[model samples]
Target chain A: MPSFFTGFELAARLNAETRRRVAALARPPRCVALLDAANAGMAAYARRQQAFAGEAGIVLAPEPYPANPEAVMRRLAELAGDEEVDAVVTLYPLPAGVGALEAALALGAGKDVDGLHPENAGALALGAPARPPATAKACRLIAEELAGPLKGKEIVLVGASRIVGRPLASLLLDAEATVTITHAATRDLAAHTREADIVITAAGVPGLIGAGHLRDGATVLDVSINRGPHGLVGDVDVASLEGRSVTVTHVPDGVGPVTTACLLANIAEAAAGRAL
Target chain B: MPSFFTGFELAARLNAETRRRVAALARPPRCVALLDAANAGMAAYARRQQAFAGEAGIVLAPEPYPANPEAVMRRLAELAGDEEVDAVVTLYPLPAGVGALEAALALGAGKDVDGLHPENAGALALGAPARPPATAKACRLIAEELAGPLKGKEIVLVGASRIVGRPLASLLLDAEATVTITHAATRDLAAHTREADIVITAAGVPGLIGAGHLRDGATVLDVSINRGPHGLVGDVDVASLEGRSVTVTHVPDGVGPVTTACLLANIAEAAAGRAL
Candidate 1:
């Protein structure tokens, strides 16, 4: 069994680092507004905001907007117009209609830290100078920590969502790693997983990856946060891989906190006018 | 030895179908301009245009822009703004860059027949009403033609380019087929292909799939178009699959023409504003 760090721990360390970095730069406090119209829980976001506020001038406003992203974008554009906001972080899942993400990306690229903007997404995809999506950057960070230097490694991602899978794949590919993306409809999912030296599962399916699905000594990064009677379960079955040469990052301590911290880092970058 | 079709034959049939479809609908001549900036081969574009012109009032304009997609997008937007233009089409190769594809997609979803628009791409990924990419659709059509109804069948797609691989996987998933998408980086490409009831290879690697890669009675669709001394070579080594329980599509005739027709169909759909 390997040591596990919860999302809280990751977020804490990230916030600490962000504070130190922001303080060193002698910059003004950053304001981050999370549009929670998609019904993303506010508790986690609040917790992240408080952590940031303790160290720097941080405002975490989770404004609920209409489900229609077009309308939301219009309102967001208006809100952004009024405030001298440093950065806008959106926590909602991909919107229902087309261009929702595109609209978010269009929130004046300089103010967008979420990296879901098409320009940023395209930049990341092309390995150009652009801030990578926070969740994807977090996933890559986890992979880097678990497995040093991913170049030429056979990394298989089990999900291809725009936020996680596709963007992550692009990031990994840019890093010189040979990446394969699998989805729910993928045939012989186990076959692909078993061959991967590193497996990143973000398909949101609990117990999708088990010892049976992976080869011995394979590093597994589970990104799913499925709640069960026991507790939060990941895409990988951590309990079953206790004796295997597998390193499991527990759900709560794995990607969540790191992702939040990365979000803040993105905000800081946007505030600093970092190109990527 | 398995037979292969020349590019000329494929283009001829494709033009005839385009003309017939346009005539049936009593519509104006549809113009499809191939942006060959990536390859800069106007002679090839001219030949393709000639095929279409013989059937309908087609115009072939060769305007080379920087490979960077923003410039290409502006050009596409300019073309889409024309009153005489009904739809727009662009040919893509490995070097054309995703930016070009993205630009083609951004040419107003109403005029995007290739279904490469992010909105349409997302819809295809979600198994919605939007048409799949033309190449992927052609691959599916060929697979079904060779081996009726792919439901419950095992299919393996080599090469996961957004144009062919990713969308093809989505189409197969919609058909209730078990699909696996592998790339050059895949650890055991042959192992997966050998087990598949249908092996569709799109990797430009000439003869990457041969008799050894196919299981007995497996249907093979070679989507690669590699010109060589013996003429065009597909991803699959058609000559080696001679007595095996296999049915392989020729490089020139098989999926190429179907893909062209599918693109024309997508253009028609775009002009008609089917999804709008």
Candidate 2:
């Protein structure tokens, strides 16, 4: 049977370290704020950031998101000007008509803890210093945790969303790994997946990746969090990899926990005025 | 024998359209400015822009090259404030102390004809509307001119520079092609290249790609302009693809001319306050 790459365990370790780092900082308090636009789905995500912020000994400042784009931009501008705030993460699924690009740019790059701003994304695209999207960061950490060193490794990443595959490609490329990015238009998903030393899926399609798609013992990180009939599931059909020697993360416990941990670590870094 | 996908052909094709478009616009004359840093290579490049701007009925405003980053930023700010200038194209190889990112950001997205700004780059990354990087835009046009459509095709890009590979990846991805980005650290460049239906090399290493690295009928675009003993050459040894049925562009006439044309086209679009 494939050994589960214990995400919760690793997150716990990182979370404790984050707590220590935040504790050492001289302060009345360091703050990490979350801005949401009344989207219930985003509320769940905000809760996750809140939990991580608590672990890192940072204040979780939640903003009352307005309905209009201009109002939201005003709120973001105010937050950008706030000297007390160290980082700001916007909850997704914003009240429609407001794009992430505008929201991210408005948040200002340095306070953009989630790395949504183009400055950060552009920096990551060129393999420079900036906080990477947490899920993408978690995927890298999971691969390093399992594969040891990624240099020269062949990686097939399904989905090219800026939050995940696109940014992750730059990170992996910078780490000296050869990366192939596939998406809805990919002709033969399995053909590319089978050729990789590692396969990461963020397609948001239930049961998109399985045993046949991966080489024997390849590490897999699933970033798509979809609500399925069986409850919250990932892009991979984790059950289908059964009895193989593959190194994989358990569905719910895998990428999610690590992503939260990475966010907290990013907040800690941004507050310290240096990258961790 | 492979057909040479003519760069001058597409550029002339694009340039005529740009002329007609700019002529159609009612204007006291929109101006396009160039900011140079006194680099010899960039001087050659700036002259090309000057010629293009002159042809388009746009003024080629040249900022006196300065030796310092602060001076460049100051000039860029002045250009940004200019009411007459519709676009700004910074000459390449800016003084050593300045990075392209800061200069680009200072140029401001609306006036950045080269598409170097993070806003434009980020919009491109997400496949949203923004000025596409000119070299990347030319690469796409060349491919589309030959291949017709890119959907479901496998593309191997051999450089990840902001000017080429990175932007090209987003463009191809948005067009529904699978893209694999490789670089100097990529373990087996030929393995990836051999599997691709299209190969675009921007890696500056002269003769980095050869016939053996490509599929028999694959399309190749060499973006690297290396000055060799043979004068100027591209990343690929185009002579090696002699007998194949490949569709390709010539070294000097391949991607360079189209890049210049695309910049003019972008200027027209930005002047019109739209993305073409």
Candidate 3:
């Protein structure tokens, strides 16, 4: 069986650290969250966030998702200027017709805890002031924990979602790793992965990467969280790919926990004001 | 011998079109250029820009590089709020200690014609409201102009500079190309380029890519314009790599002219107020 890399351990350690940082703050960092409706993919995340915020000693204020695009921008713009709100993050769905880009732009770059703000995204690409997406950042942290450094490593990143593959490529490139980014358009995805020292799949399709997708001892980080018959799963078939002499991060406890931890980290940084 | 791709033709066509765009504007789109007195690399660029601005009927205003960090931010902050300014750009040698990022951040997204502003960069990454770095955009334009959609194409990008490789990757990813980004740390760069249908080199090292670097009939765009004994050169040895059946763009006329054109495109959009 493959040696499992668990975000549960990393998240626990980070939470302990977050508690210390929160206590050190002059006042509890005020975090305002826009709770997405249950139909949206963020209900589970919202539940986890509220519980986590309490443990970290930060004030988590929840609000309903705005009705229209105008309301979305208005609410975000309002929170952006409020002195009490040090951080602002919205759930996955910003109403049916709303786009996250517009809503994120309305949120002040300093208060954008989720790092969905374009300013944060630009900072990540520029290798400058960083407010990277939590999930992508967690992938790098996991890779580093397993492998010493990503320098000179050939990494195959499957998926180009702004949340994962895109930002992850920036992070890996910053680490001096040669990165190949493939998506749904890519033909023969395994051809690229077969030549990689590390393979990270965030394609969201369950069992998209099989045991044949990796070579012996390759490190695989799965960022996909899908609802499979056997509870939650990731982009790869972890059960099948487990015994191929590969290292794998499981579905339930893999990237999910670290993503939550990184969100706390961003909130802490935003409260501290990361701008130079 | 490699086939050749020339930007001179594209530059002429774009310039001819720019003349009409400039005539259509209510007033000349006001451009602010912040120049550094020291060894900033933009002295030659500013010279070309002045000539180009006149030809295109755009106003080019020069400003002294601000003194300190605070002054840099303050000046950019002032420009950010000014309704009269359509675009803002800066040269490399930013006084002594001024960081480009702080100045860029101060420029605000709407007026950052060079697309260095964090918001613009983020938008480029998120694949919305695209105001990509001029040179990067030029590469994609050249590629698409030669070959149709980049879908499923294997492209090897030979640099990771903020100006070119980084943003180009985002644009190409949006185009659905399988992109492999290599930087200074990449070992055996030739091996990667060999498998690519398209190769782009912006490494800034003169003669960094040679004849052996590409396959037959591959499309190569050279963005590096180095000042050699013979006036100007590029990252690839055009003289040497020219006969390898590779479509090589000349150094002086390849990516340089297109960059200036793209800058104008951004200014045109900014003048019209691209913000929501």
* TM-scores, one per candidate: 0.76, 0.89, 0.91
Worst 10 residues of 1 chain B by lDDT: B1-10
Model 2 ranges off by over 4 Å: A24-49, A61-86, A126-128, A269-276, B24-42, B61-64, B68-70, B273-276
Considering summed lDDT, which 10 consecutive residues are worst modelled in model 2 chain A? A28-37
Ranking by TM-score: 3, 2, 1
Instruction: Report the lDDT tens digits of candidate 2 across residue range A156-235.
Output: 99998878888888778767788899999898999999889898898999889988898887888877789988798887
User: All models: lDDT?
Assistant: 0.68, 0.79, 0.82
Q: Candidate 2 clash total?
A: 0
For model 3, how does the per-residue alpha-carbon lDDT over B86-144 read when each residue is reduced to its tens digit? 88888666766677777777787778777777778888888777778888888999988
| TM-score, first chain, each model | 0.85, 0.92, 0.93
lDDT of 1 by residue, A1-276 (tens): 544545666567778777776665445545555445444455465655656555544455555545675786676676566445677665555445635555564576667676655456545543446787788899888888778888767788887666777677667755656666677666678877898888888988888898898887788888888878897788887777767777777776688768777877777766666322
The positional error of residue A46 in candidate 2, measured at the CA in angstroms, is: 4.3
Compared with the true structure, what per-residue lDDT tens digits does model 3 show for residues A102-221? 777778678877668787888888788697889888999989887779999999999988888999999999899999999999988988898888999988899899887888889999
TM-score, chain A, candidate 3: 0.93
Which segments of candidate 1 are over 4 A away from where they belong?
A2-41, A49-58, A64-74, A80-83, A86-132, A160-162, A176-188, A269-276, B1-45, B53-81, B87-133, B144-155, B160-162, B166-181, B273-276
Cα-based RMSD of the predictions, in order? 5.5, 3.4, 2.9
